[model samples]
Target: MTTAPHAETFHSDGTPDASGRRVGVLLSHGFTGSPASIVPWGRYLAEQGYAVAVPRLPGHGTTWQDMTTTRYDDYYAEIEREFDALRARTDVVVVGGLSMGGCLVLQLAERRADQVAGVVLVNPAVNSTNKQLLLLPVMKHLVKAFPGIGSDIKKEGVVESAYDKTPLKPLASMVAAWKQVRAGLGEVTAPVLLFRSAEDHVVDPSSARIILDGIASADVTERVLAESYHVATLDNDAPQIFAESAEFVARVTSQVAAS
Candidate 1:
């Protein structure tokens, strides 16, 4: 399948910090959205001398039909692969993502608590209140997909490279995976930095609430994005996301070194 423009994976090996301990950040994009959505954020982290890895999930960055052939595990395996590689190269690693990607990293935080130093999320989605989704199991058998939820950016002229449709099978797989992620949330003890948009059409507020309530992290912080939508990483408040995440990485990595 031909990949969409700007949808390729992005990676950078950064310089070591002042303490000579290298820090890495692994970022993931949203469902149906490609690395194009978060590569700018990854670039900003790399500029701050932090190793960065942004992997393209399976069945994504291509036609929506291709997504139907893959499941949630397929996407997450790609994330885990890049994450392990980053961890091998750096002294400590921080994981973050947008929407579904955010949920994936949360899974990593829960399952690999001993390895993950910190967690960052932007409009992460674990649960949805959409009534139509209740029939996903049956609907997925009857229909192949629905309209796409890409490019929910508030900024004018900014377009995210994403699929034009939402594949039902993959969506169902993701929703099913959410149950496991939620069940394991309390296992995540690393510091967390969560960013939620005040207005997001694709993901409702229930996800943010669930994450905040379920995670056991004592140093959890939630910030509200007033000017952006679901795809905040590519929206008007992108500069803030980049700068704050850089600061967050430094603070969390320093804490790791101190211990």
Candidate 2:
């Protein structure tokens, strides 16, 4: 499938603060979704003087067929590469994401605790109560894809640019990565701000429960998006996410500087 123009990656050259220190924010989109899913959030941070990078995952922003050839490791490697690049240019880095992007950033926070100053997640999926996911190991061999989980937004006229089908093999890989990330949640020390939609259709609330209960970070906050669904970043509560995230970045970076 031809990639939509809006699905392209987004990057911003951040300006340094008065102290000559630069702050970078890396935003990751969910599985089968492109940078378009989180561009507004990234742009809001960039406008607030933070450098932002929203990269298209290796197999995303293209076609479901392309995503079939990729794995969770490929997605993680892409985020890792973007994180290193942002860290090289800035003094403080804040990472955040939606859905699977949230899982990837949590993994980064676990491994690079010293470099990651803060994290923001929207409807993060660490564990799921969905029984169908359990059969992925076997279903992947029999089925090439499943129904799409994209555009789970409550707001009218807003649609997410994502795949029409969920590729099975890559999804199995994602499930494996989710297990690994959940096991290592205790290693994350960075401050966290999480948003959960009260009525999500794709990811169950259990995913949010696991994240809130497992992460070792003492500085964690959770908010409910009452007016949205799974893709709250583009739904009715998007403004709340954008505003709160900008504040979260500022607060954490300021605290880091004072320390």
Candidate 3:
């Protein structure tokens, strides 16, 4: 029932870029996870003088039981609100996420193509080949949850501070929303930078394949995180994620500003 420290929402208005343009980045955490997982990444970007917003999804950051009270729409609605707020203050915005957060930002790119300057995804999950997930609709009614998918970091001392249980109802909703997100992937025209861990335990390679194959963006880059796991943003390769994403943001935003 208690929220973890650093699980709260984080935002910054940021200083203007070299172009005197105020650019922004919005990051969403994954299902059953909170902003605590990605705040460091956001902070890294904010320090680069880019406005940043990291919103805690509705059902997360509290307890698994609390997550049962919400659905995927609740989470996406919060992302939409934060995206709109960032857009209000910045000339252009680049959206990114980890896991389900990645899927949520992809939805943003689909619906607001003109507004999203670029997309950065870390271990984004869109589809799963897991046979157990197929039983979610029936299993959710019979049971409350399964084991948690938290703290899949390859680093020994690092823990994700995420929920210990994966609420079935919310998980099912996320799966359903994936269909919707996949349907609109072709609408996502913004350049995409995706990072997949070579040794991930939470999300598998299928999700990445679906995303790369479905999106319409011609400018897509995929990098393999050789040393990290699912939570690469907080794993051993975090520095790589932060530095490269900063470069990705710079390249895309400048292109958008020029055009």
- Candidate achieving the largest lDDT: 1
* Per-residue lDDT of candidate 2, residues 96-198 (tens digit): 9999999999999999999899999999988888888899999999999998999999999999988999999999999988889999989999999999999
CA shift of 174, model 3, Å? 0.4
How well does candidate 3 match the true structure in TM-score terms? 0.98
RMSD of each: 0.7, 1.0, 0.9
lDDT value, residue 229 of candidate 1: 94
lDDT of 1 by residue, 131-221 (tens): 8888999999999999988999999999888888999989999999999999999999999999999999999999999999999999998
Candidate-wise lDDT, in order: 0.94, 0.93, 0.94
**The CA-based lDDT of model 2 is what?**
0.93
lDDT for position 57 in model 1 = 94
Q: Name model 3 segments beyond 4 Å from true.
A: none
Q: How many residue pairs clash in each candidate?
A: 0, 0, 0
